[model samples]
Target: MTEYATGLVYPNGIAADEVNKVLFVADFTGLHILDLVTGKQSWLSDGGGTYLNGIDGLYYYKGTLIGIQDSGNQGDRVVRFYCLLFNVDR
Candidate 1:
């Protein structure tokens, strides 16, 4: 297990796959998947070349992981958001 210091923030959303015994954690940088049995963590997606930051909601459904990303202030642009679907395998 890993620990973080106070004021160090990340991982905004989470989802659990009971059938596969896995945990999904959404961070501002990427999507993190954790194996409950092995305690190993990996990235499902890194948002490379995509607007996939500020992830606020997470859900797992039928081999797909859905993420809700809120686009925070990027210059004077209006704040927007979008949902992303990722195919995740157990």
Candidate 2:
């Protein structure tokens, strides 16, 4: 298979949104989004002031992004992100 992405520190999990043609990748660095059609990579920031880090599992459910995080100081928890809130529909 061909490498679709690079420059990730520690890739852990991924989820795809077929309807939006986008791919969500979670790594040790942060959360990232890849456009399937345009091949554009972008960083996803939490506007709610939640700093995402050390994400290990990713899931896309009903237009929402669910992230399983295993951080050192933050501990283990789940985070939900509304896909439509981000400017990824381009």
**Which candidate number maximizes TM-score?**
2
In candidate 2, what are the lDDT values of residues 1-90, reduced to their tens digit? 745678887899899985767888998888988887778788887666886778899999988889898857278899888877544555
- Relative to the true structure, candidate 1 reaches a TM of 0.61
User: For residues 1-90, what per-residue lDDT tens digits would candidate 1 score against the true structure?
Assistant: 553212214878777764766777777666666766666666654345545556778877665666666657243222222223322354
lDDT of each: 0.58, 0.81
TM-score of each: 0.61, 0.84
Which residue pairs in model 1 clash with each other?
none
Q: Give candidate 2 misplaced runs (Cα > 4 Å).
A: 86-90
All-Cα superposition RMSD per candidate: 6.0, 2.2
In model 1, the runs with Cα more than 4 Å from the true position are 1-8, 18-20, 73-90
Per-candidate clash tally: 0, 0
Sequence-dependent TM-score of model 2: 0.84
